[model samples]
Target chain A: MTATDTAARMLDRGVTPERYARGWHCAGLADAFRDGKPHAIETFGAKLVVFQAANGEFGVLDGYCRHMGGDLTQGEVKGDELACPFHDWRWGTDGRCKQIPYARRVPLRARTQRYETVVRNGQLLFWHDPEGSPADHDLLPPELPGVGTDEYTEWFWETVPIKGSHCRELIDNVVDMAHFYYVHFAFPTSFRNVFEGTRATQFMESKGRPDKAADAGGYGDADMVLTSEATYYGPAYMINWLEVDYKGFVTEVVLINCHLPTGPDSFTLQYGITVKKPEGLDDKTAQYIAKKYAEMFGTGFLQDVHIWQNKAPVQNPLLCEEDGPVYQLRRWYEQFYVDVADIAPDMVARFEFEVDTTKANEFWHEEVAENLRRRDAASEADAPLEGAGH
Target chain B: MASFVPTSEETLADQRLYTAGWLTSVSCQDCLAVVGVQKNSAHHTSIQWSAEALAACPEMGRRPRELHAGCPRLQASIEQAVRAGQVPIGAGDGF
Candidate 1:
């Protein structure tokens, strides 16, 4: 079949691997990758080996060694280099061949794929690009206090492996505002969303009964105004901040969700939760509250896995006014799957919405805006020059 | 600065321009337009070029071009520059 015909067939059969944007994907918790050991990770059908150098810097490279296709994770690490298990061909942090035993000289082109990585907000993020494009902009994790410190508790993580699912559907949940009331039982008071290029924000204020709030560590009996703001770094990574205000007591929690596709119709959802300790609370009480909140948040997020598991892929949803900006969100998401050359025009025609930040704290809006500013500046600096020769 | 006087009466004064090794500048010989300029030191080097410089090159297109005509001689010069480890200009990135 011709290329166009093959593409159509793949789309019709829903067998194509969804294209991902060039940004960071959560490898795992930052502390999970211990020094002198390599961790195996799978994303976008690529087996990646995540390792920490002796200098404390982390790197992600192709899991298989360039020589003889040996697994790098099973190899031995000495200082900042890795020796292949089969042949002991040592590779450096940059994925370049360092030493080849029994050979007079190492080939100049002997190297494997090395992905860019960064640690932010206690999470280890790996960068991916199909065309081998370098990272143009950085992913800035939420600036949360008491993270990775003795005063605050460590993050609690859970993994939910879903069958026959794609990440785009989960992304659709960000703009499905009406579902709050019908599906999740959240009473919406105010809702708005803003999309710009690779970033998106959803601000929601709602009132839900204790049954719904119970999972999120909310007092189900008391009526509370729960303000939630979620930000997307790319198609696969999202950070959500939720605040519960009721009866003069407030509880805040941050949820980091990373959706990684293992196959065409399968993905693993990595969910992490962390809470802040209130001021003037004793160490024992603060720890208890943080732990309790983590438990509740984890329970609440798991409630959606059942629905996501059974839902069919909807390419074009019959959207309504109250259904929130699902269409707009879809458009923003389309840029990631399309050719990178089309990103310029797509971003120009992106939907612009006026976000209501009155009920939201600075954490929801101000920080996101600032991060976008820095990201845009960096992108401009790195953009290839465009012009006619003359 | 002090310089020694010519000791021989038959000595001839040479008139040639000399630039430092760290501040070399390259220009297109055909159009006589500045192409690439760089600053270098013992430990670091920084080079900068303009996309328009490549696009404006007299012979940037294919030979006997269909879209736009270009001079074959100038195209050969660009190839030579590339071989000489100098920045060669090309019209568009073919995006």
Candidate 2:
């Protein structure tokens, strides 16, 4: 076979760079970064080495060094530069050859590709675009109650590595509403979906009982109706606001689901959850509730993971009357994988759908206001007698 | 005693001299982090430096990481050394 044809066959073996969307992909949680240490992670069909300089500058460089193709992960971090183990060639955070221990002259072309990085909500994200263009839109981390404040417990994170499926396959599961009744064993009473260009929102009410729900934090150990409002920033990140109602009482929990594609056929599913703490609750109690809620969500999400691992890629499937907007969702997802020129006008038009999540917004906004009020009150209490002291 | 000229002394005092001290790696006294530098490329063997890696530097907690990376003090030293034609340019095993 010709060399060009062979390269084409190789691209088809797994997801090539062209299939990668222009968006921010999760690098890892903020706590994972250590100063003066290099972290090597595989994502977007490349091996990336991330490191924090002695000055606290974060840099993402191509894992291989320019000289002798040395593996940078084995290299030592020197100040803000990474020193390659093979030759002690020091690379600056900008991927430029800052120093060569044995050579006085540095090559002009001695540099590697550096990915753009941004830290948000305690998570590090790197922008990936096939064409090397800057990110067009900003992906904001959802504003949830207790985030960055003591009023809410910190997010308890759980990671599960999946094989034999692409990240898009996992994203597709979000819009597959029918799976709740069959796979998760929850009966959905109503479902609403909204798709506007890059973002999609799904609001659903499911009738189910928590296997072992906590009594504190307004949660109960009884049968409850679960209402969920999920907002997708893109195909990679989602913020799901879940409200568990036990008769008159309701507790809100926000689940931030971020999927990082490790390879063409593999990805890591990171699930982080934070629960709104009840007033007058101790730190220990709040932390316990957060952990329990995280585990509960982990248990439920794994059901979908089990099915996803075994299922093959279905390009086209016979649609039933009851199946939720799977085809329309697929049309929206096409823009991520394929170029704009390849997509039809009719498919592009399907991206304009809307769902009302007014109640969910009210619930979150109220919690934020309460947290701010409590913070203000605490600050006032700490203030000394300003007029008398002067 | 008199200031010796380059033709008589063989090494200029103003030039960066690569001394034996350049081989020794120095770290921040506070954070105990190693400072990055070229050991043998210049006339002066050893140089003193400081850096902060983040906004809240775990070591000093005073400067932003970005400011530390692009510190004018370090840049000014390099620029002065280069303009004076004192920094070595020929191929040699870098220190």
Candidate 3:
């Protein structure tokens, strides 16, 4: 069948439902580990926790218990299951009760809610797409080298409350290139050129802030690529990718962001700083790495958070003709945010993800040098054109 | 922002209301009148409300007289001249 026909069929009501701005989203909950060790992940107005069984297998569960809505995280972690602290009602990853201390035996109806979950590409993937249909595939970044390594890496995570929707801010930040220069004024250049690689791809940069009073061209190459696409996972969340080639410059440098739901008016940001361990790395290496990422990339994000938080607490509007990926992202998000046939309450999980933030801040120094070199070249070419052979 | 209102042809006899991410609209037999709203407000500020509340809604105020806060009585009062509509709501600027 043609794509249009398939698309229409995919969108037909009663076939699947879309809730939230996108049907389902991945928040990079945890890299590894489980034994009823609950990891809570919030995104797009939803809260979920994943309990890791001692046997390395696990189950997805609603973060809140049906009985008194007590947090299941603090409960006892048995062999490959969990026992609710309030009433000692035990459950497995499938959300079914394994035993009931207060009952004669396990009741047939004693089951904690569960959701359809799949572990893919080193991350746990869940359906947040409105239809919660299988047709909506898993969303993952292209596999890069050293994705899940404990040798040169260590990870820690902190979930911060952000008062705003994740899609608008995420889509905005992923496609925004100009902001890198202006918004991040801590760097040398205030403006940077663009090298468009295609409709939705841009690589490298051209010119930026030029320094006239100083020695110029003392910089090295610093490059990044921006790619955007719409995925089956959701319509609103643009499937975006950014690849930065730092070429042995910094001690530790990374950029990462994932969204989760905290409240209807807010979401949480989960990031990992992929830091290559330094020679004398201390035990608090994760903290050092996170500090660098927060200092560099996180500040700029903080500014964006301010803007997003202050915006109307509803779906932000955009015109496809103006906003590059807004059209597809909006279409994708509608299925999750507006459609109801896709709502699933059992999708919640306790998220505890790995974040290696150990790399040094050498990249900013390189960036400054690169900006200086460009300025020097432009000035040399622009200055005293030898009276143009009059 | 668009200065939009249901075409005069629209009448309650024709249609009903629906909501989107930030938009809520009353669709009649002829046209659709839409207003942007914070979706979370539904937990407390529902489709049911007073005329003053309807007049305070974004885009709903453009024709405050037409927005009934989903209350038939409010609409009936304004339609039958029992109540007088006031200034528009949510424009962030005095009209």
**Candidate 1 residue lDDT tens string, A1-390:** 333322532212223444555567888788888767887877677787888888787878899998899999888786788888999998887888888988999999998999777778888877777768776554455566766776555687777777777776678878775555545545555666656557777777876543333333322222566788888878788888878665557877777877777766677788887766667777777667666666555555555666677876644344222344554576567666656765644342323232222333233344435744775677876543222100
lDDT of 1 by residue, B1-95 (tens): 11112232221111010011122355566764343332121111212223454356555433543211223444445446555867422211210
lDDT of 3: 0.40
Contacts from the true interface found in each model, as a fraction, amount to 0.00, 0.00, 0.00
- Candidate 2 residue spans exceeding 4 A from truth: A1-18, A140-146, A209-222, A246-249, A340-390, B1-95
DockQ, per-model, please?
0.01, 0.01, 0.01
Indicate the docking level reached by candidate 2. incorrect
What does candidate 2's lDDT look like per residue over B50-82, in tens digits? 233222225334343321122334334544554
Write candidate 2's Cα lDDT for A205-241 as tens digits.
7664132232111221335578888877766878888
- Models sorted by TM-score, best on top: 1, 2, 3
Name the lDDT value of residue B31 in candidate 1.
68
Predicted candidate 3 versus true structure: per-residue lDDT over A1-390, tens digit per residue: 333322532221111112254434454644554434676665444556677778776666777767667777667768777777788777787778888777898768777656556554355555554344442443433343553564334434444677645444554443343344444332222111111101112222222223311221111112211221211223322222223223332344333455665554466665545555556667377556545544434554665666677754222222211112232222323324443544222111100011111111245456656866876677775663221110
CAPRI rating of model 1: incorrect
Candidate of highest lDDT = 1
Q: Candidate 3: which docking quality band? A: incorrect
Local distance difference test values of all predictions, in order: 0.60, 0.59, 0.40
